[model samples]
Target chain A: MLDAFGQPQSLVVLGGTSDIAGEVVRTLAQRRCRTVVLAGRDRDGLDRSADAARAAGAERVVTVVFDASDVGGAARAVDDCFDAAGSVDMVLLAVGMLSHQRDELDVERTREIVSTTYAWPAGALTRVAARMSEQGYGRIVVLSSVAAVRVRRANFVYASAKAGLDAFSIGLGEALRGSGVAVQIVRPGFVRSKMTAGLPDAPLATTPEAVARAIAAGLESGAPVVWVPGVLRWVFGVLRLVPQALWRRLPG
Target chain B: MPERTLLCGWGRTAPTRACVLAPEVADDVQRALAHADARGTVARGLGRSYGDAAQCAGGVVLDMRSLAGIGDVDQVTGEVDVGAGASLDSLVRATLPSGWFLPVTPGTRQVTVGGAIAADVHGKNHHVDGSFAQHVAGMTLATPTGLRRIGPSSDPELFWATAGGMGLTGVVTEARVQMLRVETDQMLVDTDRFVDLDGVMAAMEHGDADYRYSVAWVDCTAALGARRSGHTGRAVLTRARHAARDDLPPPDRHRAPSPPPSTWLRAPRRVPPHLLHTLSIAAFNEAWYRRAPRHRTTELQSMWRFFHPLDGVADWNHLYGPRGFLQYQFAVGPGEGAVVAAVISELADRRIPSFLAVLKRFGPSAPGPLSFPVPGWTLALDMPIGPPALRACLDGLDEAVAAAGGRVYLAKDARLRPELLDTMYPRIGELRTVRRRVDPEGVLRSDLSRRLGLDRGLDRGLDRGLDRVGD
Candidate 1:
């Protein structure tokens, strides 16, 4: 249950080790959020995130083993997370993979990227939404990317996965309307996180904290969609109208 | 489960969305409190607090109205155990037929028992009977931990904290209140018109003790003209007391009339945005002042007319329009009555249009730390949120009030600066200590608490935790 000030008492993060997810939990903990459930595969990374959440003010930090790429086990994993943490006020789905452009055509890499970025998340989130609808109140935050607006050749594989997830999340929000469940889609142009460390800086690049703040505010204000830099929504609106030749010619 | 909806106080300003849940029983309240998310939960009752005290943005709002049940009244003692969600109107209807009335009631009977306690609301009879909490013998508070029955004698600290605690301490489930015995449902009101502020103040200071209820409706607009001639603060003073059985007509003297159910006049759901502008309000005030007799004594008036005239016009707040209005009410100690005069003059000088300002003399302050009244004078005025300088002017008045050892009523405050909170309420730290004991995790929170920095200690705890992790 979110309080009158929009502070949640407990939060369950599916990709708990993600930089953006950790930042969101830390911010909420600072505002007196007492319970945090971190679900991820990396033990050491999960420990670090749990420690940060406790330091940020969470009274209890529960870490659960989760593998987002285990598409067949997604439903069980989500159910386990909720079973461990009763009545979650918010569930953040911040899982994705950035396969190299050269590996885009490789069958195995393509299958892995699509499975990790979209297939497993969609499977798990569907289960999460069902549980939320049963309880009649919950917020699900899906981290998409600006790449989904118009898939450039440089990151078409990752963009396509995000495009599928983004559309699914929006439609899911509509499906859950009046059921007391909400799905917030967060799109960032380029976030300065460990995932994008080696990539060249993109225009309107933001930090994990910035993305976390935007997500927190969006949930507080009950906004359906939030853009990290905010201006990306307008930027993408114009990019979508550009001629195909001009858009394709643009450098990465 | 919580449903998202926009809620505003009686003043109708700064509407915010909250996930509202109506809990039917004490257990429901406990479950809701246990699950309330980070934003925190605050209990709401009748929404009569004039400001955001009852509203919690983005958080769960426990609508206690579902807890409505009036228990058997103690015939010998005039004591009753009433649900916190039960409105004074309902209680009055039930108890009045048994020859009893509320110990203290504000200008309206629509307020809930929980709201009355949360505000420690003062009625026109404050000089005689104190506030609503003074007569409350015991109560059941559903805190984040669990439900606990407390009273003034048992755990006085928690009891006083919950009283005027603004529903921050916990959600009041039920209260054992002592009702006042009355002979009739009518009042023998004495109406007097004063030509200047000093005249009315002098009359109240000298003769108010003679009556159980007294209030003055000052014409702020009329004072503007009087200010130039060195005379100001013209008002219409009405003082009254419960009429005795023999005071009524000979035919009706044997029995008290049953109080009327409040279906008098219904205000339109939506009025023009600027219906109560300067010209219109001024005209209304002028006519209202002139309409009262120069001096009338022992005039027989119904309980509805004397105590809650505004209740007749349901949804009167909508008349202020879409922009809404702010009810700026402040209290100053004895010898600081000039502060009231200065505020009225200032509002008039700024060309700020205010409806009839209510001026009342407070007898003494309650033991509750956050209670708004004190031994002196209090004035409440309604001004539209149109003037560009309205915010600045009110801010200035806040400083002046604080400097004079006065405080703005939190129940009616929407814009008081957080920095001035401690100065206005010196005992806030003590209240915080008591609050933490009841709500250790800070599960109970509201928009007003966030706005006034009452939740600072919760954040401070986070900083402390971070320090420990660093060590």
Candidate 2:
């Protein structure tokens, strides 16, 4: 359902999805969404995801193959998805990787870590965010982390990476303001998913299913920030103000 | 700002605003009741009720006055459909043409049909007709469960509950009230006044059964030695149901008085903060003796002019000025009446002069949970408004009344403390149970409710238990 301008008017996410994007899709669906373009890198994963989404009751789902690390073509890739569908209603920036913590101590490895986890995704999403702003009716959802609140000695590199991304998401949302384009930032704590398999459970860690619910609820509630395992907002609030000596002694 | 609804009782005097709904027809009453039942609102009548009985504190009072229609009068059966808010004056006028009258009239005709039913008011005729509830043929009450047309035949428990149920049972919109066929608008004459207080009681007790109407007029301003004009007047409408049809008068027709001189109004005395004291009261008593009458009764009086003389005064309360007077009307329950009477006499002996004294005999009490009447003697006395010292005197009366197992009238009270009220009426919790069932959403309320915390909405027995513990 492409317009004469050949831009997507709506979008959807199939299986390889971000929690916040799934929520934004559900919100639009409730409001009677008509056309949607589903974009992801894996065609098979997208098709499989589409089947589940159609079952969960999305009216439409389409897939676009792309590599987010290829920043030069990222903006063009977004336009193609809209050209294939009708127009873009939402662009969910849920692509990221949690680099190996021990590998980050190596300077050369840290550059790779920063590129995969931050630089490319940041640059690519900014281009997509601007495209949506030009469309004049768009929603950009960015996945953030609670660790972005403060960088600790143990996870400072990961925390710092998230901190930069969080600031980018917030600043991007503000830039889109008055353009009729809105941004939603989701901040989830340690969430259990296939990506986090084989790792010990973190205190206040939440499951993917829990994160999904929080995402959808946040979109419906129009919240600026979200914390999974909901009470952690308060839990982390207390953690931030405690005397440093007392805080360091408390095991996570 | 959004406002919450509250409930008002007959004894409370505070004013509050909630949405007001006055149902006009049965169907309207039903719809309002259903809506309030589904949601909730307090159904109230002519805010004439003394306390919160007609108000729902923060809630709207469903002003029942809109249901003021007096249905077709049954000249044959002496029955009439009275809209809940119809005043007794209107009902009497509408029905008297057919030679019928209210089975019982309270001290005032200004009371609405619904208010009378709620209070189950009685007059000098209580010894004969019992409370007003006894003569109610049927009533239409709007409850949480739609409209229930009830009477002795339909849902007897609820019927009894609605009779003297105060407004808690539901909004009683229209009632098939039984009217008595009267020989005339005028009552058969008889009057005998006593010189002393005991003579009045002795006369009422010895021969009250002989008269359908009996009452006493006391010179409250009489001196200690001579003012206790223990004088009681008694009368009965002659059973000879023969009225010269040619002279048939309207219901409101009654004898008029020679207007008292403006100076006759003692209210101008300003009731100084200390005027109600022992010596002042004694002095007033001495002056009352100067205007003497040992015993006497004027004959052939119109029933309204006799029972409800206040109806003629327009705004009689204005006579008491901005400081509105408090009428302490209490009756002893069974053996308690004697103690109350003794207390009243003692107050006079102590020089606390009551401007008016009305004594009557109550029949077997109504089983309504919070019905005020008991099987004993009752007295209604009025006192001019004054300062704190006078309040202390009333508090003393309250203690004695509560001690004697008696309660004051809620509709006539303005300053009674809650402790004595609870002591007098122990069935408040029981009444609240029915109130909640009738209006689950907690809507019906009035100003009086806020004063005494009647519709407090919380059932924390710890407070009650604590009060008992403190006692």
Each candidate's DockQ score against the native complex?
0.03, 0.01
Cα lDDT of candidate 1 equals 0.84
CAPRI quality of model 1: incorrect
| Weakest 10 consecutive residues of candidate 2 chain B by summed lDDT | B462-471
TM-score of chain B of each: 0.96, 0.78
TM-score of each: 0.67, 0.54
TM-score top scorer: 1
Tens-digit lDDT track for model 1 on B1-471?
Answer: 445777778877655667889999999999999887665789999999887788765568989897879987898998999999999999998889878988999999998999999999998988777889999999999998889999999989999988888998899999998999988989999999998899999999999999999999998873335447543478999999999998999888877559766667777888887899888888888888889999999999999888888887888888987667888999999799989989988988887888979999998778899888888999999888776557668878998999999999989987676678999999998778887788888877776786676776765322222111111
lDDT of 2 by residue, B133-219 (tens): 778888888875677788877776677766666676677888888888765666554655455556666666777777777666555
- Which candidate wins on DockQ? 1
Off by over 4 Å in 2: A1-252, B1-13, B30-40, B221-293, B296-298, B349-353, B456-471
Q: Which candidate ranks first by lDDT, i.e. highest?
A: 1
